[model samples]
Target: MSIAWDDALKVGNIEIDADHKELIGLVGDFETMVKSPKSVTPRSIQITLERLQLYAHDHFAREEYIQAIAKYPGLAENKRQHDALRKTLADYIAKFEAGQFGDLGKAADEMAAFLNHWLMSHIVDVDMKMRGALSDEGWR
Candidate 1:
Protein backbone atom coordinates (compact mmCIF):
# COMPACT_ATOMS: atom_id res chain seq x y z
CA MET A 1 0.00 0.00 0.00
CA SER A 2 1.20 3.48 -0.86
CA ILE A 3 0.78 6.27 1.66
CA ALA A 4 0.43 9.83 0.53
CA TRP A 5 0.30 13.02 2.56
CA ASP A 6 -2.92 14.93 2.15
CA ASP A 7 -4.84 17.76 3.75
CA ALA A 8 -6.20 15.33 6.32
CA LEU A 9 -2.75 15.03 7.80
CA LYS A 10 -2.13 18.73 8.22
CA VAL A 11 -1.96 19.96 11.83
CA GLY A 12 -2.27 23.70 10.94
CA ASN A 13 1.32 24.48 11.85
CA ILE A 14 3.56 25.08 8.88
CA GLU A 15 6.74 23.83 10.53
CA ILE A 16 5.13 20.73 11.95
CA ASP A 17 3.27 20.12 8.72
CA ALA A 18 6.48 20.29 6.74
CA ASP A 19 8.21 17.96 9.14
CA HIS A 20 5.37 15.51 8.91
CA LYS A 21 5.52 15.66 5.12
CA GLU A 22 9.21 14.84 5.16
CA LEU A 23 8.62 12.03 7.62
CA ILE A 24 5.87 10.55 5.50
CA GLY A 25 8.11 10.68 2.48
CA LEU A 26 10.93 9.01 4.38
CA VAL A 27 8.64 6.29 5.62
CA GLY A 28 7.40 5.75 2.07
CA ASP A 29 10.94 5.44 0.83
CA PHE A 30 11.77 2.93 3.52
CA GLU A 31 8.66 1.00 2.69
CA THR A 32 9.58 0.90 -0.98
CA MET A 33 13.13 -0.19 -0.21
CA VAL A 34 11.94 -3.05 1.96
CA LYS A 35 9.25 -4.14 -0.48
CA SER A 36 12.02 -5.36 -2.71
CA PRO A 37 13.87 -7.40 -0.13
CA LYS A 38 16.35 -8.97 -2.50
CA SER A 39 17.45 -5.56 -3.76
CA VAL A 40 18.27 -4.20 -0.30
CA THR A 41 20.55 -5.53 2.40
CA PRO A 42 19.86 -5.81 6.12
CA ARG A 43 22.47 -3.15 6.70
CA SER A 44 20.54 -0.86 4.36
CA ILE A 45 17.38 -1.41 6.36
CA GLN A 46 19.30 -0.67 9.54
CA ILE A 47 20.52 2.57 8.06
CA THR A 48 17.02 3.55 7.00
CA LEU A 49 15.75 2.78 10.48
CA GLU A 50 18.49 4.93 11.96
CA ARG A 51 17.63 7.76 9.60
CA LEU A 52 13.97 7.51 10.56
CA GLN A 53 14.87 7.57 14.23
CA LEU A 54 17.02 10.65 13.82
CA TYR A 55 14.42 12.50 11.81
CA ALA A 56 11.75 11.59 14.33
CA HIS A 57 13.93 12.89 17.15
CA ASP A 58 14.39 16.19 15.39
CA HIS A 59 10.71 16.47 14.55
CA PHE A 60 9.66 15.75 18.10
CA ALA A 61 12.06 18.35 19.41
CA ARG A 62 10.71 20.93 17.01
CA GLU A 63 7.13 20.15 17.92
CA GLU A 64 7.89 20.26 21.61
CA TYR A 65 9.60 23.58 21.21
CA ILE A 66 6.54 25.02 19.54
CA GLN A 67 4.32 23.60 22.20
CA ALA A 68 6.55 25.08 24.90
CA ILE A 69 6.51 28.47 23.24
CA ALA A 70 2.74 28.35 23.00
CA LYS A 71 2.27 26.98 26.52
CA TYR A 72 0.21 24.15 25.08
CA PRO A 73 -1.63 22.20 27.73
CA GLY A 74 -1.12 18.92 25.87
CA LEU A 75 2.62 19.25 25.69
CA ALA A 76 3.16 16.59 28.33
CA GLU A 77 0.97 14.12 26.51
CA ASN A 78 2.70 14.90 23.27
CA LYS A 79 6.06 14.24 24.86
CA ARG A 80 4.80 10.99 26.29
CA GLN A 81 3.62 9.86 22.88
CA HIS A 82 6.88 10.91 21.29
CA ASP A 83 8.82 8.91 23.86
CA ALA A 84 6.68 5.86 23.22
CA LEU A 85 7.26 6.15 19.47
CA ARG A 86 10.99 6.37 20.02
CA LYS A 87 10.92 3.23 22.10
CA THR A 88 8.89 1.48 19.45
CA LEU A 89 11.39 2.40 16.78
CA ALA A 90 14.24 1.18 18.99
CA ASP A 91 12.47 -2.11 19.49
CA TYR A 92 12.02 -2.51 15.76
CA ILE A 93 15.69 -1.83 15.22
CA ALA A 94 16.65 -4.37 17.87
CA LYS A 95 14.43 -6.95 16.28
CA PHE A 96 15.91 -6.28 12.90
CA GLU A 97 19.43 -6.62 14.27
CA ALA A 98 18.49 -9.89 15.96
CA GLY A 99 17.15 -11.31 12.70
CA GLN A 100 13.81 -11.86 14.39
CA PHE A 101 11.91 -11.27 11.16
CA GLY A 102 12.97 -13.56 8.37
CA ASP A 103 10.67 -11.86 5.91
CA LEU A 104 11.88 -8.36 5.57
CA GLY A 105 9.16 -7.43 3.11
CA LYS A 106 6.46 -8.52 5.49
CA ALA A 107 8.11 -6.73 8.35
CA ALA A 108 8.45 -3.60 6.31
CA ASP A 109 4.81 -3.73 5.29
CA GLU A 110 3.76 -4.02 8.90
CA MET A 111 6.10 -1.25 9.96
CA ALA A 112 4.88 1.03 7.21
CA ALA A 113 1.27 0.44 8.13
CA PHE A 114 1.98 1.08 11.80
CA LEU A 115 3.89 4.24 11.05
CA ASN A 116 1.21 5.51 8.71
CA HIS A 117 -1.54 4.88 11.21
CA TRP A 118 0.41 6.29 14.12
CA LEU A 119 1.39 9.42 12.25
CA MET A 120 -2.07 10.14 10.88
CA SER A 121 -3.70 9.51 14.22
CA HIS A 122 -1.21 11.61 16.09
CA ILE A 123 -1.53 14.50 13.66
CA VAL A 124 -5.30 14.41 13.66
CA ASP A 125 -6.03 13.68 17.30
CA VAL A 126 -3.02 14.99 19.21
CA ASP A 127 -1.21 17.55 17.12
CA MET A 128 -4.46 19.20 16.05
CA LYS A 129 -5.03 20.16 19.67
CA MET A 130 -1.95 22.31 19.51
CA ARG A 131 -3.31 23.92 16.37
CA GLY A 132 -6.53 24.68 18.16
CA ALA A 133 -4.59 26.23 21.04
CA LEU A 134 -2.59 28.27 18.61
CA SER A 135 -5.73 29.42 16.86
CA ASP A 136 -7.22 30.46 20.17
CA GLU A 137 -4.10 32.48 20.90
CA GLY A 138 -4.05 34.02 17.41
CA TRP A 139 -0.85 32.21 16.57
CA ARG A 140 -2.35 30.24 13.72
Candidate 2:
Protein backbone atom coordinates (compact mmCIF):
# COMPACT_ATOMS: atom_id res chain seq x y z
CA MET A 1 0.00 0.00 0.00
CA SER A 2 1.17 3.50 -0.76
CA ILE A 3 1.62 5.95 2.08
CA ALA A 4 -0.53 9.03 1.73
CA TRP A 5 0.64 12.48 2.69
CA ASP A 6 -1.66 14.25 5.12
CA ASP A 7 -1.81 16.96 7.75
CA ALA A 8 -1.10 14.41 10.46
CA LEU A 9 2.43 14.23 9.09
CA LYS A 10 3.05 17.90 9.60
CA VAL A 11 5.06 19.11 12.54
CA GLY A 12 4.11 22.79 12.20
CA ASN A 13 7.59 23.59 10.96
CA ILE A 14 7.35 24.91 7.46
CA GLU A 15 10.78 23.98 6.14
CA ILE A 16 10.73 20.54 7.69
CA ASP A 17 7.18 19.99 6.56
CA ALA A 18 8.17 20.72 2.97
CA ASP A 19 11.02 18.27 3.18
CA HIS A 20 8.75 15.69 4.76
CA LYS A 21 6.27 16.11 1.95
CA GLU A 22 8.94 15.49 -0.65
CA LEU A 23 10.15 12.49 1.28
CA ILE A 24 6.63 11.08 1.42
CA GLY A 25 6.30 11.58 -2.31
CA LEU A 26 9.48 9.67 -2.95
CA VAL A 27 8.33 6.87 -0.68
CA GLY A 28 5.04 6.75 -2.56
CA ASP A 29 6.87 6.49 -5.87
CA PHE A 30 8.91 3.58 -4.57
CA GLU A 31 5.71 1.90 -3.45
CA THR A 32 4.25 2.33 -6.88
CA MET A 33 7.29 0.78 -8.51
CA VAL A 34 7.26 -2.08 -6.03
CA LYS A 35 3.75 -3.07 -7.09
CA SER A 36 4.40 -2.60 -10.79
CA PRO A 37 6.08 -5.69 -12.18
CA LYS A 38 6.70 -4.11 -15.54
CA SER A 39 8.40 -1.10 -14.00
CA VAL A 40 10.64 -2.88 -11.56
CA THR A 41 14.35 -2.80 -12.37
CA PRO A 42 17.43 -3.09 -10.21
CA ARG A 43 18.82 0.10 -11.68
CA SER A 44 15.70 2.16 -11.12
CA ILE A 45 15.04 0.92 -7.60
CA GLN A 46 18.66 1.33 -6.63
CA ILE A 47 18.65 4.91 -7.81
CA THR A 48 15.52 5.68 -5.85
CA LEU A 49 16.80 3.97 -2.75
CA GLU A 50 20.14 5.73 -3.01
CA ARG A 51 18.47 9.07 -3.45
CA LEU A 52 16.33 8.49 -0.38
CA GLN A 53 19.36 7.45 1.65
CA LEU A 54 21.32 10.54 0.61
CA TYR A 55 18.41 12.88 1.23
CA ALA A 56 17.75 11.30 4.60
CA HIS A 57 21.30 11.90 5.70
CA ASP A 58 21.23 15.47 4.48
CA HIS A 59 17.89 16.12 6.17
CA PHE A 60 19.02 14.63 9.45
CA ALA A 61 22.22 16.63 9.45
CA ARG A 62 20.39 19.85 8.79
CA GLU A 63 17.85 19.08 11.49
CA GLU A 64 20.51 18.23 14.02
CA TYR A 65 22.34 21.43 13.26
CA ILE A 66 19.18 23.46 13.65
CA GLN A 67 18.33 21.69 16.90
CA ALA A 68 21.80 22.39 18.19
CA ILE A 69 21.65 26.08 17.31
CA ALA A 70 18.20 26.24 18.88
CA LYS A 71 19.54 24.72 22.05
CA TYR A 72 17.18 21.74 21.95
CA PRO A 73 18.00 19.66 25.04
CA GLY A 74 16.88 16.42 23.47
CA LEU A 75 19.30 16.81 20.62
CA ALA A 76 21.40 13.93 21.82
CA GLU A 77 18.61 11.41 21.73
CA ASN A 78 17.34 12.78 18.44
CA LYS A 79 20.79 12.45 16.96
CA ARG A 80 20.93 8.89 18.18
CA GLN A 81 17.70 8.12 16.38
CA HIS A 82 19.10 9.69 13.21
CA ASP A 83 22.23 7.60 13.47
CA ALA A 84 20.24 4.42 13.96
CA LEU A 85 18.17 5.10 10.87
CA ARG A 86 21.28 5.80 8.78
CA LYS A 87 22.74 2.49 9.86
CA THR A 88 19.58 0.56 9.14
CA LEU A 89 19.23 2.12 5.69
CA ALA A 90 22.84 1.31 4.93
CA ASP A 91 22.20 -2.30 5.81
CA TYR A 92 19.14 -2.37 3.58
CA ILE A 93 21.22 -1.01 0.70
CA ALA A 94 23.80 -3.71 1.26
CA LYS A 95 21.06 -6.30 1.02
CA PHE A 96 20.08 -4.89 -2.35
CA GLU A 97 23.62 -5.27 -3.59
CA ALA A 98 23.66 -8.93 -2.64
CA GLY A 99 21.34 -10.14 -5.42
CA GLN A 100 18.32 -9.29 -3.33
CA PHE A 101 17.07 -6.50 -5.51
CA GLY A 102 13.71 -8.25 -5.69
CA ASP A 103 13.44 -7.44 -2.02
CA LEU A 104 12.50 -3.90 -2.99
CA GLY A 105 8.88 -4.69 -2.26
CA LYS A 106 9.63 -5.73 1.28
CA ALA A 107 12.04 -2.85 1.70
CA ALA A 108 9.53 -0.32 0.48
CA ASP A 109 6.89 -1.69 2.83
CA GLU A 110 9.24 -1.66 5.77
CA MET A 111 10.44 1.84 4.92
CA ALA A 112 6.89 3.14 4.78
CA ALA A 113 6.13 1.60 8.15
CA PHE A 114 9.28 3.09 9.64
CA LEU A 115 8.58 6.50 8.13
CA ASN A 116 5.08 6.64 9.58
CA HIS A 117 6.15 5.41 12.99
CA TRP A 118 9.17 7.68 13.14
CA LEU A 119 7.40 10.78 11.96
CA MET A 120 4.40 10.41 14.27
CA SER A 121 6.32 9.26 17.28
CA HIS A 122 9.54 11.20 16.89
CA ILE A 123 8.22 14.39 15.38
CA VAL A 124 5.21 14.69 17.65
CA ASP A 125 6.50 13.00 20.78
CA VAL A 126 10.19 13.86 20.88
CA ASP A 127 10.84 16.55 18.28
CA MET A 128 7.99 18.70 19.52
CA LYS A 129 9.42 18.70 23.01
CA MET A 130 12.73 19.81 21.58
CA ARG A 131 11.01 22.53 19.58
CA GLY A 132 9.32 23.76 22.71
CA ALA A 133 12.62 23.87 24.48
CA LEU A 134 14.18 25.73 21.58
CA SER A 135 11.38 28.26 21.54
CA ASP A 136 11.70 28.70 25.26
CA GLU A 137 15.37 29.45 24.77
CA GLY A 138 14.33 32.19 22.33
CA TRP A 139 16.37 30.49 19.67
CA ARG A 140 13.66 30.61 17.03
Measured by TM-score, the strongest candidate is 1
Query: 1-140, model 2: which lDDT tens digit per residue?
Result: 44567787565556566677777777777767767766766777778778888887887887787778776677899898888778877887787778764565666566556555544554566555653344423545
RMSD to the hidden true structure, all candidates: 2.5, 3.2
Q: Worst ten-residue run, lDDT, model 2?
A: 130-139
| Per-candidate TM-score against the hidden true structure | 0.85, 0.77
What is the lDDT for 21 in model 1?
A: 92
Off by over 4 Å in 1: 135-140
Residue 104 deviation, candidate 2, in Å?
A: 6.6
lDDT of 1 by residue, 89-132 (tens): 78878888999977767777777777777666666667777765
